[model samples]
Target: MPRPPLPDDVAELFRRPNPAVVAVLLPSGAPMSVATWYLVEDDGTVLLNMDAERARVSWMREHPEVALTALEEGSWYTHVSIRGRVVRWEEDREKALADIDRLSRHYGGQDYPTRDRARISCWVEVTHWHGWGAAKAD
Candidate 1:
């Protein structure tokens, strides 16, 4: 499917170094959210990393469905929201570590610390998305 449009402000927000906050719905009907480092791959997939034992990971394990939104800093009304499914998950320690390193370098311009190697990585396929901006009109 074609990717949705990202408002100019929202697109700029994703380019920053600050982590994006994603709100996910748990299988039990509750909501779980987290601030995660992410990368918008050239293929358009959004990659995320988290500890294997994190609540968001457990929620995804039981329910692959999730909603993600990128909030614009210092603004009350600009954001991008996406509803999607977790299409891939790798349990291989080495591969996950490698992916984390790749993403970190892509987003942070550096490699993942050895301490974070135990974390798991997830790849999300966006099914739908919408973006909006709220900057004052001059």
Candidate 2:
């Protein structure tokens, strides 16, 4: 099935480097969430990268379903929430590095500072989404 498109206002909000949190399911089916850097693709898919050694990476590999919520700068009430699954995993370390650099540039002005370690990149194919506060639909 085709994916649902993010509304224009919500998409615009995502284009900015806002604070985001991602939630993943644990082995026991409990949910764990952490702050993360993310980039939204034109097709509404979300790009997320993590340090290769993190436990969350293992959890993601074992269970692909995830959710992310991005909050507007200085306004927590205004946010966009997305539920999706990891539709693609970039196994190449070089490509993962590039992805981290891209995310770094989006969040900051320069490339990722730590280049000595491997990174894992995944693309979340958004299946459902909604916005609140200013981006909310009337």
Candidate 3:
């Protein structure tokens, strides 16, 4: 099986603005998951942003490993899951702000609703991935 982005069929599912849930490890090594907005970059990396004050930001900084499952909108069974690590963390509020705006436009068709809060962004380098349902690996 291919790693990370896989081929176009599986990758295509991620390109859409689908609902996604990201899972990360807590300090106790237990898994925690939260629904989040994500973007698939041209190079196949995943982009994610969060409020700087959120605990998940600190948790991700402490444990870079993460898994994201992107489900095709309106068709939950068709999905792709990627296991990856945070390759870069962007704390520059300006850059984070811009990235979040881009994500909001992709997901909600407008700029991020809140600008008062600082944002942080992370780039995930997918290491392994697989798909299920219509996107299932052959």
**Best by lDDT, which number?**
3
Report residue 20 deviation for candidate 2 (angstroms): 0.5
TM-score of each: 0.75, 0.93, 0.95
Off by over 4 Å in 3: none
Superposition TM-score, candidate 3 onto the true structure: 0.95
Point out where model 2 deviates above 4 Å: 1-3
lDDT of 3 at 73: 95
Q: Model 3, clash count?
A: 0
Candidate no. 2 TM-score: 0.93
> For residues 1-138, what per-residue lDDT tens digits would candidate 1 score against the true structure?
225544455555655554467878777788878777777766567788777777778888788887777666666376666778888887637675777777778766888777544678777887877666652222
lDDT of 1 at 14: 58
In TM-score terms, candidate 1 sits at: 0.75
lDDT of 2 at 134: 92
CA shift of 95, model 1, Å:
2.3
Kindly report which residue pairs in candidate 1 clash with one another.
Answer: none
**What overall lDDT, based on C-alpha atoms, would model 2 receive against the true structure?**
0.86
For model 2, residues 1-138, the per-residue Cα lDDT tens digits are: 223676666788877999999999997879999999999877768999998888999899889999998999999999888899999988437664788888999999798989888888999998987788997755
| Two-way TM-score contest, 2 vs 3, winner | 3
Q: Which pairs clash inside model 2?
A: none
For all candidates, the clash counts are 0, 0, 0
